[model samples]
Target: MKTTAPRDQSRFAPDTASNGSVSPKNLLIAVDDSNATTRALQYVGRLLRETPNVSITLFHVLNPMPRELMEHGGSENPDMEHQLGEQLRKDQQEWMHMEETLEYPILERALERLRDTGFPTDRVTLKLGYAGDVVDTILDEVRSGGYGTLVVTRHGPPGAARLFSSSIADRLSRDLSGIALWVIE
Candidate 1:
């Protein structure tokens, strides 16, 4: 699917070339509403203040698989499978609703903080997908969307292992070309 431009681009500084022309740059930020992610966004905002012509994208990955997926095998019974599928859909819907009602407020707060610090709201992009596959999806979007940089957060010493294992950072750094990866503390 084609990625759409974020609605709040006006909050950031306008891009201008050395020759006094427009030169826009795309920035992708992987966020999960964690403190580390917040730090990363702040760091990206600072970088954008220093460097003009950049847009920031805030991406969140939502894993859709349920615990039952691992426990339940692909049974031959169509009825059972259908019931399981329905349950999964219901669970997913509930999760999405909870996120929209609860987590969205937190995300909005973070976005407001960034805006208060001078990052344009229009530059922010939010996306959702499976957490484990976020790296591949982000990379695909980066290539297709023409983003120039990716700003990702790295957890502190104690939580670093979990973050690295779950995060898309390492894969993105290794696989994606022509995009700068910034890992914040």
Candidate 2:
């Protein structure tokens, strides 16, 4: 008997390029619902419209796993553990629902927006993932994806909090070396 892995949630755009050779220009765009994210995508749209032979991946990382979903492997009492397991299972279902309904829509809209700007469809790819630390997650993708340019938005409203908020663009910029970091305003 064979078991199959769960289907990947990513929707890779159909490559429209005629030639098989990979484009030398590759960009990884990390997106969210913030205004900053819109700015980043718009910037890419404008850039890609004029520039040819560029490939871009639209990457979105979902919020880290909720505490309720984490499994407790060891329990002194079997009855108590069984109840906990059931609750976790329900939480897992909810998480999957959020992925399908909430998360995928963001990526879909982002893709549609870029396509509307006349960017090549095949040259774009979508990645929906679980984020640990936002900065670390992005760096891992950048390294593994071979992206020459990592494009991310500087999120949050302009204020002192903007400097202190949970925005990871600054951290990413500091941590990233040898890779071009584009922090869209």
Candidate 3:
């Protein structure tokens, strides 16, 4: 009987890329400012540390205040309505600024963590989307971006757990039938 060293299957394992050429493995990670998002990114970074030709795209979705909030512009009291409209405009501007300034550091931190795990800095990208319906926006990005995998944490922001007890993840998994979804606990 001949005995031989076992081959490393991981090295031979085939990965999914669009074409026959070795395209980078593209991953889209759903992110927020929550600890869950940070943890999920950390997990993914460590897991794919040595993966060749891998790329990661951090995707963030922001929901602006409902249009109804500004509908007070037509209220009976013109002066009061004018004040309310001003306030709403200010609030919208503040949200937009937050989107620009706050999101950058969060993405930078995630990029740093992935870099620490041996992933190349140049292979990472960040994308931002805005819509009233967060799920729809994420799905739209997934379809347009052609990501091979979708990663998200089970819970969202601190207070959202009570309202959406795994609902977002469940809905995303069901809706994204063809795409790969990873819901990290």
lDDT of each candidate versus the true structure:
0.58, 0.68, 0.66
Using TM-score as the measure, what is the rank order of every candidate, best first? 2, 3, 1
Highest-lDDT candidate: 2
Tens-place lDDT digits, model 2, residues 1-185: 01111236333432422443222377888877666776778778877766876888877776777775677575789998898888888888788666646777677778877877778776777776565566777787776666678888775556533421345777887888877888877
User: Where does candidate 1 stray beyond 4 Å?
Assistant: 1-24, 50-53, 69-87, 99-102, 156-168
Give all TM-scores, in the order shown. 0.64, 0.73, 0.68
Please say which candidate is ahead in lDDT: 1 or 3. Answer: 3
Candidate 2: residue 59 Cα off by (Å): 0.8
Model 2 clashing residue pairs (backbone): 14-122, 15-122
Q: 24-70, model 3: which lDDT tens digit per residue?
A: 37788877767777778779988886788777777666555567654
Mark the regions of model 3 whose C-alpha exceeds 4 Å error after superposition.
Answer: 1-24, 66-95, 157-165
Model 2 clashing-pair count:
2
Candidate 1, 67-143: lDDT as tens digits: 65434455689998888778877776676566445444545555665676677666665554343466776676566
- Could you tell me the TM-score of candidate 2? 0.73
Q: Which RMSD does model 1 reach against the true structure?
A: 6.8
* Clash totals for all candidate models: 5, 2, 0
**Candidate 3 accuracy as TM-score:** 0.68
